[model samples]
Target chain A: MSSGDHTAHVHRDDYGSRMGMWLFLFTELILFGGLFLIYAVYRFMYPTEFHVAAMELDTVFGAVNTIILLTSSLTIAMSITALQRNRKTLSLVLQFATILLAISFMVNKYFEWGAKFGYGLYPGSEMLLDKPSGEILFFGLYYTMTGLHGLHVLIGIVFIGIIMYQVWIGRVHSTNYVRLESAGLYWHLVDIIWIFLFPLFYLII
Target chain B: MANGTLYMPETEPNYLDYRGRFKGILGWILSTDHKRIGLLYLYSMGLFLTVGIFFGFMMRLELIAPGKVIIEPQTYNSFFTLHGIIMIFLFIIPGLPAVFGNFFLPILIGAKDVAFPRINLLSWWLFAIGGGLAITSVFLPGGPADTGWTFYVPYSIRSTTNVLPAAFAAFILGFSSILTGINFVTTIHRLRAPGMDWFKMPLFIWSLYATAWIQVLATPIIGITLLLVAVERLFGIGLFDPALGGDPVLFQHLFWIYSHPAVYIMILPAMGVISEIIPVFARRTIFGYSFIAFSSLAIAFFGSLVWAHHMFTAGMSDTGRFVFSLLTFLVAIPSAIKVFNWIATLYKGSIQLAPPMLYALGFIFLFSIGGLTGLMQGALSINIHIHDTSFIVGHFHYVMFGGTGFGIFAALHYWLPKMYGRMYNEKRAKVGFWVLITGFNLLYFPMLVMGWLGMPRRYYDYLPEFHVYHFISTIGSWILITGLLIMAVNLILGVRRGAKATDNPWGGETLEWRIQTPPTHENFHEIPVITGGPYEYKINENGQEEKKYEEVT
Candidate 1:
């Protein structure tokens, strides 16, 4: 919807929007929560292999992506604050910056996955099949969890991109910025999940 | 009525009418009105029920005389698989919450509509798309999924059938469920009328609240599990594939983690419907109001912990088995609390033997049998004997079909008039109830016995020793289907041609009764300030409290 396309009816409230967003974030956490559960179970089953496989993950790339995600999380939170204070240009710029960081994180993820594929560590690969089952599981979880995390980064970018436009058009301004805040919370959630992911996959070694 | 008094006899633009901005079907299909959305769910559920039951009928027909009477084993496998998928995902899981919860939750809690109406509409659209995808899978080259609705790994991974579409369809349906949950929870928390406290809210809303939490929290696990299954099938992702270092049994762990809470999802709301009906007919305040209310939350909480009971025979540890078994039996307490309260509410009270009340009583009876048999199955030693047998199947049907199915019927009879503004033939409704119950018991009870005697489920062919139970069960299916048909015809005719009903026909104390019989498009003319609890049945003729003094004593 356009900036001026705000409907006249239906009373809107910030608290309800925030509560709805919080509840939704719970679902998203639990969405990744399931993956983490699987990860925990497998790690418990195969710690040595998981640790060995963790050494194979490119730490520099993961560390860089983690920095990008955390920074992006900061920018989005600042963006919401800026919007709340009616700093329109600043809010839009911060949001755009957040989007760029999300893209950078994904770019790093792509290279990491490509490097793994180059090494023939992809799921169901002959090389992977020859590895110990624990190593197979560690790499499997790495690719799947990070791949799913990458998907979230992609979704979060699109989400922020929309709000960036909304903020520009004044549809998501000081008076009506819950949309922006909600998107920010989602971005932070994506970042938080990556924070856990980065340590699990890259630092666990 | 809002206060057990005011109602609109004069006509207005009811939600059922094509009086909205969009003309005709678009008015409903495109509408964001909770009532319209509820109807959309109701209509779609009816369609799926028919499709599910027809498959069920075919399965029964094939099982009538034992060895592949009318269909091959493969066909039978696909039939039961498709039936379970459609019935569980499309019908039962979404049955009460999507339909009745949508229609009445807003009204009962004295809100104009749910917290997020647009999201509510979106939920239905997703439901439609998910349903379409499922139906489309049936005609695909490999035919419908034969891996069963559970989509247990290894077989699910190895099956040549269209697993991805079916699994993804369920995944998509789970989103609709999660969204509905979000809306209901937000609405309950944020949208209640000024004076309507949580306890003052009707038991249906309480049940919906409990159901919504499970839907929101538990559904995502299944969503991720299903997606992982799809991903595994699509790309040989070693997540659940044992050949790829993935454990297959872990799949069961994740599946039932959601699926078991899903049973509470199916039954809790049904129990809530019975709770609403019992006190209304009995003309007394609900016995143990907060007890019934908290017990709903209790069931939802305890229900999630008992998922491993499903895996006891799947090679669990003795400690794991012992723990899950204890939790499973413990979870039965809330349900028992509800049952006792319902009976106590009915005792010595001025009970109206209405069709709704009959179905309510029937629900208790059938659901009790279902619950008791479930206890039998839950016992660690006993479950090993009947793990994959017809006894488990019988217990499942009694709870789901007999309990939730009859629960839906009771709800339909009780509120259809408020929905359509017309009354059905009570005598005919009762006849449908009777035949359905009789056919139900005859159909399922024997399976329980046969299960104990070692009749394995999901088999197209049975040994001649099991032939007698199969025959009787098939006959029961016939009677059940006939009863269902009669009930369907009766309700359909009532909606079309029956006499118009007055608002507050039941003289119940819910807010929906305060408005038009068929509520207006906006639902409330003015948002009602709740004055009292939902089931305060007033005294009649002699100004007595309508106490069945002796019965309570």
Candidate 2:
């Protein structure tokens, strides 16, 4: 490696940046963890309600969104690898593609939520359907979970956009791949969260 | 390099060169230096503490007579709610660790700076913003929040108070804490000087590491929990509002999951401080270094599980109560281990009886009593009688106030010379220590007795029988406040004109004392590798010897 390429050799102190990200992810997990626990307890209490509520959600839409997210994750992973192989232009292209895919997933989510809203399933609105207690419980989980996941998708899109800028500006390259790796880790987490979200909201029913 | 002995010069005026001092007021406001950031937290927390104390004193004055003396009952509720909120979140939660820990942890560990100094600065600013918002809630149109610090839901939902601002402030403060935790964890993991292994690291860093874990892993739940409460309050959502078929108890669970570990977040660093002070004054290796270090981690690990103990009276099942109570008792074991080890470290060593040592000793005695009382409350049957009573309040005060508060004072005194390059009056410090400890017991101990006598807490007024205890507690509070005032004044004066401190005023073997009184921009002249455990104090053929590890570089 060139002597100017300081980032290639991971400084012993570099763990701080990585560890900070890991701890942040830990906090994010716990934040989402509490909601998961709530979902678990409520689901256990009202299985039939959850089942029916799960059925009401469009599986096809969710499945499409999942595919979009998964594909974005792949692009992000490839971007990191492209940067690692000194293919800066390729990396930037991949990051842009990832951001585009993330935005598309969010667009799909907007439509899906809009359809639910049209169906009188909006939380606290007059249009909210009068369902069994279990179904209401399921809807509560649905809104809270999907709303939170949507927030994550928005955040992911922003992060990818920033990464795209960094790559375009030639700040990211093979030697300086920590940012890409960190961003990839976050993108992968978003994908992993959707893996769970898909089965719970779409497949399990 | 040169036996790995960290040496800081005495007449090094350049060491105190605050880089942003040239920027004038803006320098302090926008500076990213950890020292300045720590001072910012100190000043903000000090202001909040004063406000909290004012509210507390008002409560005490109101109780001076059987009826309300200065304010109406609604005002009284707001006063006490602000008091609890400010004291718990604004002051004590960040009390020492945010102030001294931020200032000294990196220096003590011999690193150039905290791993994330910019984030460190951001945490303090967030704290200031949160504190400002919380205080502003006092004058809002609907009056201040009256749901107390815990903010239990249905009442919180229905109460015509400015609950949103207060809850939002708390949510923001949780973010500050999480950021600080993230910074500290990374610093401890990556910033240790070469050869400063986990076991050789100062107990303070170990405690901080554990505390940071709680901040990172637990505070977010409270953030979400508070946000949900705000959403419920503002938009009429019913997540926590039990009147709308929501479960208030679920709020309790979410709150305690964070709040329970939060108690440890308050004390673990105090325990770390006491460990540091004991070894320096006792002139010996800390008894059971590994155990003390691991106990901190153990406490952090177990602290999360026992949060359910707080929910015992919230109508949990018998099996749930049984499991929680048992876990609660188990949590105290690590604490007990720490107490035992501290005493053992002091067994046959030369004890200096300095002011810091005095406070450290006070922490041991008071924290022990507090921990034991906590165990008493942890018992399923006993908690039923005293769950919402003054006894529970008393127990927490002893732990939080007596334990964390006393430990903070100990650290202030211990590090005062190092931080400011001056010596405080020994006579004044001793008097302050004794007065504070005496007044602290007087202030809180009687509430325990009255709690047992069936006196409920948070009441504006009480029956005549409870008056005697309230009067005593109030008087004691005055004395406690006076002692704190004396301590603060003397230390401030001491910093300006006191005798210049030596490189190692206490002859302590820690890396912090090895540096200048006020450390340099870069803490060390040459980064010193750790050659010994922090508390190694023994004699060998090489004059006075200590356990020395190798230098990695």
Model 1 segments beyond 4 Å from truth? A1-9, B4-12, B539-553
i-RMSD of all predictions: 3.7, 6.5
lDDT agreement with native, every candidate: 0.88, 0.82
> Clashing pairs in model 2?
A49-A134, A49-A135, B531-B548, B531-B549
Looking at model 2, give its docking quality level.
Answer: acceptable
Residues B1-553 of candidate 2 have per-residue lDDT tens digits of 1143354554334334554334566666566666767778877887998899899888888887688678899989999899989988998889877988888888878776677776787888899899999999999899999998999878888889999999999999999999999988888877778888888888998999999989999999998888778766665543655544467788889889999999999999999999999988888788999999999999999998999888878998899899999999999899999999999999988778889999899999999989999988988889999888899889999999899988888988998777777778878988988888888888899999999899898898899998899888988888988899889888988888777776567868788766666676556777787777887754322445232212223
Name the weakest run of 10 consecutive residues (lDDT summed) in model 1 chain B.
B544-553
Chain A TM-scores of each predicted structure, in the order given, are 0.94, 0.90
Error in Å for residue A7 of model 2: 17
State candidate 2's TM-score: 0.94
